[model samples]
Target: MSDKRTVLVVEDEEMLLSAVSMEFEDAGYDVLCAGTAEQAYDLLRARPRVDLLFTDIRLPGQLDGWDLAERARALQPDLPVIYVTGYSNEQPRQVAESVLVMKPYRMSAIIDVARRLGVG
Candidate 1:
């Protein structure tokens, strides 16, 4: 496996996915892009070395970000996660303390959070 820290970015929107992937890459992380929950799962299953997971709260398929986070946590408890959302609705109480980044966040903010979490 490569030595660089790997970050998995899960977002359904093509443009947003590309943008976030670029942001993480620019911040000196090895980025893994997944457009759906299933793809994220596949990536995680196939590549267990991922250090960070950045997922959108509202995904396109049957499995949402919360579900994906739970599953990923089960697979690798040490993995850090950051959830991104645009809505103001109540988030899941179980993972309330998990890192969250509001939509339209700046690259610096994302990098700061990743640094704080010791992921970058």
Candidate 2:
């Protein structure tokens, strides 16, 4: 296992996925990239030491980020999650208090939030 903190980033868009994953990796984090919710779930099941989850709310699968977060919490209760979404319809009630970054969010803001949440 790597000594660096690991961040699992789930996003459907290819460019965004690469950009965020690269940023985190450059920041010294071990990044696991997933293009769909299913892939994210597979990673969660396979890895025992994920330090953070940064998922986009709208994914190309049955489960969205909120659902993924719930499932992840079941496996690791204290796992920190930062949700990214373009829709402002209604923040999922369950994760209302958690970090939510809008679509046009600056990457630095997300990194700052993760750092505050104890992730690298």
Candidate 3:
């Protein structure tokens, strides 16, 4: 087992996922990349030590990022989430201890967030 803090990134776009995964990895996190809420749930359930969640509001499946965060919170209540989307004006509701970061964001900003959250 590795000591690197784990961050689960749920994004539908392949390019976005790859880019974000690389950013997190470079920031020293063990990133778990998933394309859907269900897949994210599986990764979250399987890995008890996932330190943070950086997910997109929209996803590939029926369940959205909110659902993913809810399920993940059930497994790990203290999980810190950052929702990334293009429409930052449409504020999210019922999010627990989260940050809404707009898309077209600097990857370095996300890395800074992870560091602040103590996730690698």
CA lDDT of 56 in candidate 1?
Answer: 90
Q: Sort by TM-score, best first.
A: 2, 3, 1
Sequence-dependent TM-score of model 1: 0.92
User: Model 2 TM-score?
Assistant: 0.94
**Which of the predicted structures, 2 or 3, would earn the higher lDDT when compared with the native?**
2
Of the candidates shown, which would achieve the greatest TM-score relative to the real structure? 2
Candidate with better TM-score, 2 vs 3: 2
The residue pairs in collision within model 3 are: none
Q: Which digits, one per residue and each the tens of the lDDT, describe model 1 over residues 5-99?
A: 89999999999899888988887889999999989988999985788889998888889888999888888887788898897587563353369
lDDT per model vs. reference: 0.85, 0.88, 0.86
Query: What lDDT score goes with residue 104 in model 2?
Result: 84
Clashing residue pairs in candidate 1 (N, C-alpha, C atoms within 3 angstroms) = none
* Each prediction's TM-score versus the true structure: 0.92, 0.94, 0.92
- Model 1 lDDT-worst window of ten: 88-97
